[model samples]
Target: MAKSFASQGDLTEKKITFDEVGPDLWAFTAEGDPNSGVIIGDDSVMVVEAQATPRLAEKVIERVRSVTDKPISHVVLTHYHAVRVLGASAYGADQIIMSDAARGMVAERGQEDWDSEFQRFPRLFEGYESIPGLTWPTTTFTDRMTVYLGKRRVDIMHLGRAHTAGDAVVHVPDGGVMFTGDIVEDHSACYCGDGYFGDWGTTLDAIAAYDVDAIAPGRGGALIGRDAVTRAIASTRDFVDSTYAPAARVAARGGSLKEAWDAVRAECDPKFRDYAIYEHCLPFNVARAYDEARGIAHPRIWTAARDLEMWDALQG
Candidate 1:
């Protein structure tokens, strides 16, 4: 039987875990689903990566309310994926902050991405109708920006591109915690539909340079302690390297996309097939890898129609 598309087969509800990574930082992780980071300050709170919909984000809000009643004054978009954003309105934050590159992506393909991702991950967008519109960032920075929430420093830096052209990391220097959005997944597979495979390792290197005691990744659970954080970074690097290697080799040999994809599956599946979104991401990941192998510097935008066409081309 043919496999279900994207996360359509993943309908079972996962038990959500709200982990305290630092003094006032919380990571809302639901199994291998998209994760959100919460930083509670003395006067206000900042959230990184809004869930797919308003109803979905309410769970995060509920978790936030449990510990501190501080208003969510800021919401950060690590990237422009719909699942990681769309819920900004629900937070009622005074400002939605994102890297300028991310802001450009929002302007470029936010609508198509919203449609594409919503179709891809149905479970993640349970209350899709609740989303008001494209979540636009009110505040945008060039390379790096820092916010002060009652003396707490949260550095939002665009280290380099791994996941997208506009990927950013939330660093809490004082707490030794970093919220890495999809740049470094724990057990979950990396979604390379809009990824930069060639520069992903370099990006990982920059993130690893931080003195992180804990890491709240894009998916899976929070990596608590330095050892787990290190392992997550290493594992993420290994995963990226391993997945792109076969495809790159095949492309260098002037092989077809199918050949490259087959090799990628043969090599990556044994190790990453069981990981979260492994199957759903593999086709897109292979496509990007193949493009990168052929020396494509920037990633092409993924549209809803293109999603089905690519899926059929790969899986059929």
Candidate 2:
């Protein structure tokens, strides 16, 4: 199956859904927009994935207020994407958490990412100046760390690299619900601009082994039942495979970047034609896949200028 995109005419703002995925576990989804996961324990709250900006995060805070007054003590970052982490300060959490790798990615390329993303999607960055600065984590863990929101145990693990080198998943063992950052996304398009396509499959398999009952993907609607969860995983896997495989094959045949992009688009556009942000993501996705397929392990940093250059080179 191909990925879906947001309708160009679908200007309706997404409504937030605060659904109980399990006991003390909730998912705050905005139609097909970015999502935030909540782990409410006996005393406090842990939020997974802050929204894009402080102004945007306030909306999430409003929903969180509907449930508990327990202070949001922790904001966990699943990765170091500007759209995902730049809103950290809005949470007002005493401690911001992230994986060591994620923090490094932020320190290394956070500013460029901020400039690049803001330029790419201006609508998502409404109230852009309200952002204090690049969101930085106060506490970072190497592989795994356990936090107690009062009594509830939330295990934040960097299972493997998928979306980025710093991708992490918030696993609630007892609840059987996992808050997978960009490591997994429902019918939405996967933004693989800074991704490792070959390793992402293995990372996703590790996520599946957890036997999660429900999942809050980085983007898209929440997957409530086992069937829906399975579909989300499979759909994301298929997207990654369909996207990267053709690019890799074309590059292996000594094709130009434009040729590789065209081959992947021919294979993917027909299927994922309807996916949200398919048009927006395709150029960046193709660029990263092309680099990876050509044996460039680390994706080159993408600036605003670089973004346009790549888009122009590949899109036509």
Candidate 3:
């Protein structure tokens, strides 16, 4: 390859920020790295989105300790991505939750994703060896399930598929706060390698309907107010639209992947070049968009070898 995969070259560590997005909701964000959410209820705490590895999860645990002494009773995984779910064991929660579709994807392509992600972004999996094995949810729900953390009502729902086939969002009704997984991102490029462009916006629309006061997004900073939350949702939608349109256009005329790449860059570069992981996400996003445009409904599983092949073809 002419250059290292974009994330492979990203060695600089990001500054971590722990912000309170609601009455007892906290977001642990590290620049554009994967983000985790904390929901402190009346009795125990619930953590959303585990980091890539056990060691990385420890970082989130440290921050959670700073505020509340309640034990983490549950861990919620928003999706099946290795970067988001592999750190499950570290939490030691009594219950782990995911949408039913997420567990299906795990059975389908979990190991392939793990290998692909570990090669693509080494920095995020700082303690890869510490990860015991694939993380599995002890419990799962089909559409929506409500759990009461004491009197605090937490709703976990599969609004629709955006970033992945099984995308779950957590809503804390008391504080009007929502912990949207990758279905919503703030100032970060949506990694659409395994995404559904056709379904993403619809999912975003479902989230906007709630009009929640605050949001703990999948990445970047926490959206603390209605304005910030609205802006993030709009920006994320724009990014998805901008990425898909040009690639779909290229596909419509039976153009090469390289042509689709150029077209997407021309459209997205000026607007999203400064976004976190923009380069890392662009090639895969374009490839998937092209495939989707050509009528491929489901995304192809990405393996380590496939990652190198795609990078070499697109960036070499």
* Candidate with maximal lDDT: 3
Which model, 1 or 3, shows the larger TM-score?
A: 3
Candidate 3 lDDT (Cα, whole model)?
0.94
Candidate 3 similarity to native, TM-score: 0.99
Displacement of residue 204 (Cα, Å) in model 2 is 0.7
lDDT of 1: 0.90
Give the residue spans of candidate 2 off by over 4 A: 1-12
Error of 3 at 207 (Å): 0.2
Relative to the unseen true structure, what is the Cα RMSD of model 2? 3.3
Q: After superposition, how far is residue 212 of candidate 1 from its true place, in Å?
A: 0.9
Error of 3 at 196 (Å): 0.7
How far is 185's C-alpha from truth in model 3 (Å)?
1.0
Ranking by lDDT: 3, 1, 2
Model 1 per-residue lDDT tens digits across residues 1-316: 4465867777889999999999999999998989999998879999999998999999999999999988999999999999999988899999999999998999999999988887777888988889999988999998999999999999999999999999999999989999999999988999987898878999998998996899999998899998999899988998898889999999999998889889998888888878888877888899999989898878888888988787777766
In TM-score terms, candidate 1 sits at: 0.97
Give the per-residue lDDT of model 3 (tens digit) for 139-235: 9999999999999999999999899999999999999999999888888999999999999999999999999999998988999889999999999
Better of 1 and 2 by lDDT: 1
Give TM per candidate: 0.97, 0.95, 0.99
